[model samples]
Target: MARPLSPKLSPSIIAQAALDAVDHDGEFTIQGIAKKLKVSPSSLYNHIDSKADVIELMRGQVMGRMDLSGVDSESADWAGSLRIIALHYRNAYALNPRLLPLVTAYSVRDATTIGMYNLMAQTLRTAGFDSTRQLEIITVIDNFVLGSALDAGAPDNVWAPGEAASPELRAALDAGLGAPDRAQKSFEFGLGLLLEGLAREAEVLG
Candidate 1:
């Protein structure tokens, strides 16, 4: 009998199955993925070493959506470049917010994702940041972007303080909460504040 044109199992296929499981269940197990793929658990083991490998694959799937090639770390507009990269990174993760917790729990080993970090580091270097500051800036950006990504998936009523809300807090939430583009606007506002702070640091610390 002739073999199938496409193999039944492959890394991408397994990874996708695992990703789907995570999307639906917020977590995945070897047996869950195997059943989802209608394959034996041993078959999955053949493709991936362990659940950690699957997590990394899922991280790649999400982070791979980021396009950093057009971003020029060597440009004089290093801050602008970093801003663009942050938007790309946040948008990519916004698609799979549920995957955030799992990925954060595991050490990142995805090459594509690491490549994005490498570009961010280069951008900071161009902005006159030293090695220590570079790592610090990167961590700040990582934490902020991840939090923003989760925010993008937040419910329309992000805060429901009800009667307990102080007049000031109530007024703020009433005006902004569930507003159109609330998440995007909030993220841009926050990113601007971060960039401004970084700019100030660059002047003194560069």
Candidate 2:
């Protein structure tokens, strides 16, 4: 016998519902969101026009959670800045790993997302990379960070070397697997390797 105190329909509500769907279902449909919100499909359209639109909103929502206000390419250490950015980037996406496939299929138009990439590019440029090299480094970091985010879902014993596994591979697994922070430690380790390699490559090209 009482009216609801709040309006259920809003851009942020739509985005959050879509994110929840993606987090639980690996993808979302307008129909799915409508059902979850107990609204008709036409109602969802009032807030979001297309899957792409919803995705951009969700992207912005996730990207906004990262603290990039401290990113200053002109003053920060390029490698250190990139390391911080990559870590934050990976952690943000790790929260919604199920959304990865859907988001990756769409071109990034979210301003926060674009700004993060621009910061990465600018930092690489400050490290003496040319435009082309900046693009390459960004791609490398993107691939690695995205992969690392997805990898967060893996079990603690990420690799289980079998009886037929190579001794070298088994040795490496023994050194690395079965830890609570296996994925996280591996991500940091790989990131360091990648950043170091980029620095060396930048030097060689200079």
lDDT of 1: 0.88
Question: Candidate 1 at 55: error in angstroms?
Answer: 0.6
Model 1: per-residue lDDT, tens digit, 39-83?
779878887898899999888888878878799889978889989
Evaluated at residue 14, the lDDT of candidate 2 is 86
The superposed Cα distance between candidate 2 and the true structure at residue 31, in angstroms, equals 0.9
Pairs of colliding residues, candidate 1: none
Say which candidate scores most in TM-score.
1
Give each model's clash number. Answer: 0, 0
Write one digit per residue (lDDT tens) for candidate 2, span 1-206. Answer: 99554447987888899999998878888998888888889978887778999999999888888997887897637889999999999999988888788888999998889999999888988888889879988999989999999999877776765797798898888887877888898899999999899878867866
Candidate 2 Cα errors over 4 Å, as ranges: 1-6, 161-167
